[model samples]
Target: MLKTALGRYINNFKGFTHEVWILALITFINRAGTMVLPFLSKYLKEDLQFTYGEVGWIMVSFGLGSMLGSWLGGKLSDKIGFYKIMIFSLFTSGILFILLQFVTTFWGLCFAMFIIMAISDMFRPAMFVSLSVYAKPENRVRALSLVRLAVNLGFTAGPALGGLIIIGMGYQGLFWVDGITCMIAISIFAFYIKEKKKTSINKDNIVLSDLPKSIYKDKPFWLLLFISFVTFMVFLQIFSTLPLYHNEKFGLSEFQTGMLLSINGLLVFLLEMPIVSTLERKGVNKIKNIAYGCFFIAAGYFILLFDSWVGILVISIVLLTFGEIFSFPFVNAVALSRAPKGQEGQYMGFYTMSFSLAHIVSSKTGLEIIAHYNYQINWLIMGTLGLLALLCCFWLNELVHTKKKS
Candidate 1:
């Protein structure tokens, strides 16, 4: 019975198409290469003797890089082309990671982190834009979900694997591994992945003014974007403070903390797609799912307030995972649905930018709090903000429904 069930699972894996698998493969490589940093806070604090304020500033620099990169990458996608932008981003990011080997000072590390963060964030909007262009509307969610799965799986493996590397080879080995993997990823994209639309085939320039005003004028989309913005801001702060919390308050090791962070990715890897499909079929409104997600995430963060052990942590992880599955995909789907025909790339740019902008602001805010006060208060404030964002999601849903009716 066990063998038969295992065989069936293997069959399902084989059933995935070449294109889909290729997309997932490249995404996995990219994410795996990038996973070094989530656990780097512990390294910096313990090994390098950096203070909380120093780490906060370093993180904020990364956020600044991401904010600028996401914005420019979007515009550059229009001017230079998506695939080309991706090529530059992947290679440049790899080079930056390798450059980290020589860095000793806090300033040097901050600069390196900035370059690495910018290039990696730039790769994403372009990649997603390409996915939107290539995949059919009906299959888009599934395709994106596959990519998401690759990311989470890579994230799941990367940190746990990274923990071992940190243990055996030291912190610098993490960067060396990441840099080499990035090169491999770039090579795969360069040789294997072919764009559906060749840039050279189109000479006609698409002006920003020619784009749909719906992105600006559509109240529902705006509301949705705004609500999403707030929640993302709240959520992104967790990464900035959580490592410090575990180290100071709980005395958790890098491996243990990495394990905790990995739980978030592992949950998404196991369940995002099945949940998306089931909820889509169940007549559950997408916005409701998103709102519920925010509620759950907030609740999960608040649960951390009680200082529970593994069992309670598992419960909190479950809540945040469900929230991530529902909210992340729903927001993306809504953005795609709202986009003007043939301008999917542009819309996805703005869509991604919303999250990027939120992340930058939130990280900066979290840095300020940690700089001034404590993690306990910062987490509480962030959790409350998430609840407020959940409330806004209901208003966003009403607007979308009204617009659809008209």
Candidate 2:
């Protein structure tokens, strides 16, 4: 039984095209070297000695850049093709990441972070659009899961490597490593994936299957966006606040925190593909699965309410990792499925923008709430947001089914 289960797990990874695998490889390299974001909040607060408010503003700038980038990447992918956008986004953002180490002042750092994130995030929507082109329609979700697996694997490596780099060479080492990896990741992509003309259209020179052309008319999409925003609002805390919480509450070192965060990545890497495969095979509603995801995340946050026990942290992360595994891949698949023939880029852009917006709200609100009240209050608020997302997911499911009936 165990061997059969293992074989099934491995089979889920099969059938992807070469291009999809390359995309996954590129994602792994980039995410593995992405040492900056996980440590950004800690860096601003401790290394720079910035107050919570200042750190919040810098994070706001980061999200604003991500929002703009997400919007532009999608819109342009429709026009210019995802190929050009991916190349330009990665190469330019790499240069910016390296330069960011020099900007120490509060305002300067905010502006720099904004610019860096904007360029870096453009790769997201464009890459999603690329997968639509590269992966077979039936295999798209697995393709997405494949790429996410790369991301999780990278997450596992990045934090551990980042911890070593920080302890050995200081924060400056992170910027250089991140910048170099971005360039390296993209260079392989640019070399291997030559631009194919008239790629977005099929052999018939038109898109055959798609939803309505205008994304704005879709109420279900909008509801999903809101659900995603709420889900990620709680989710983004891991990058921004949770690290601080680990150090402050438990007095863990950077290495310790990295190891702790790595467990979430490790869990996702091990479980997401199999779980997604099982759910897909069962023909469960994506929206319902997302609601389940919302529940898990809310439970994770609420677990944090038991502050007295350090073991609660591990339990909380297990739940949150499950939440991430459930939420993100399906979210990507559903957003891709919604795009009309030429609008893949735009749809993905808006989808990613929701998370960017969430990042803006999550970091700022979380920090401010902690500043004004306490961590307990913040946890309560995040748990509430997760439940709110769960409720919205049900409403979205209804809208989708009703629209189909109509």
Candidate 3:
């Protein structure tokens, strides 16, 4: 019985095309080298001796660049194609990563960071477009789950490796190592993956147009985008504020913090694909799952309010990981499903833009709250935001169902 179950579980990972696996590999390789963003706050605070507010502004700069990148990436992917945009993004971003090591001044560092993020983030919409193009409709969610698995697995490796590098060669080494990995990913993508041709007709027999389109006209998608933006604002606090909180509140070292952050990725790596597979097999309602996820997210932040104990911190992170596993991949699946043919890049770009906007809001507002008030207040705000997102999830479900009925 056990063997049969295990075999079935393993079988869930199969059936994706060669291109899907290649895309997943590319995501893994790129994410594995993502050392800089995770430790940017620490570097700014400790090495650069920047104030919390300054760190926030620097992050905002990166966020602004990322926002623009997402928009441009979508437009360009529609116009030129995913392959060229992705190739250019990977190669140029790799070069930028290397150049970032030379900047010491505040403004210069911010400018460099902005450009680096803009160039790097252009890969996101293109990658998603590629995923939608390559995988079968029924397999789309699973395909995304596979790519997300690679991302989390790579994330698990990146920060842990970054911790060791920080100890051995210092922060400068992180940039060089990250850049090298980007170049390697570029090589893999360039040699292995071919560009997929766009389909001119969708399933509904709606003719796809090459002319400029307006995504803003889709009311339900706009609502989804709003909900996503809000949820991301709360979710992204982990990247910017949580590290600072752990360092200051618990006096933890870089290695320890990296370990703590890695917990989210590790949990997702272990459970996300299986969970998503199981849920799909069971015919679960995606919106209801998202609502549950939002509640868990709120609970995670709420846990922090009661105590600063390491055990509580562990519990909090575990809860947040649960929320992430339940919600994020499905969210992407929904976005992909809703997109009209020939507009995948636009839809994905806007979806990605939500997170980019959240980076700005979370970093700037969160750091300021910490600088002015307290961590407790920040936690309260995050929890409240999560509740709001939960409500939005319910609303989104109703709207989608109503549209189907109509």
Using lDDT, give the best candidate's number. Answer: 2
Candidate 3 local lDDT, residue 122:
90
What TM value does model 1 have? 0.88
Q: Which stretches of candidate 3 lie over 4 Å from their true place?
A: 202-214
The full ranking of all candidates by TM-score, starting with the best, is: 2, 3, 1
Give me the displacement of residue 333 in model 1, in angstroms. Answer: 1.8
lDDT of 2 by residue, 267-361 (tens): 98889999998898899888888888999999999999999999998999899999998998998898888876788888999999998999999
Please report, in order, the local distance difference test score of every candidate based on alpha carbons: 0.74, 0.90, 0.86
Clashes (backbone N, CA, C under 3 Å), per candidate, total: 0, 0, 0
> Per-residue lDDT for 137-168 in model 1, tens only?
56676677778888888888887788788889
lDDT of candidate 3 over 240-269, digit per residue (tens): 899888888888787887888889889988
TM-score per prediction, in order, is: 0.88, 0.97, 0.96
Best of the candidates, TM-score? 2
Q: How many residue pairs in model 3 have overlapping backbones?
A: 0
Model 2 misses residue 105 by how many Å? 0.3
Q: Predictions ranked by lDDT, top down?
A: 2, 3, 1
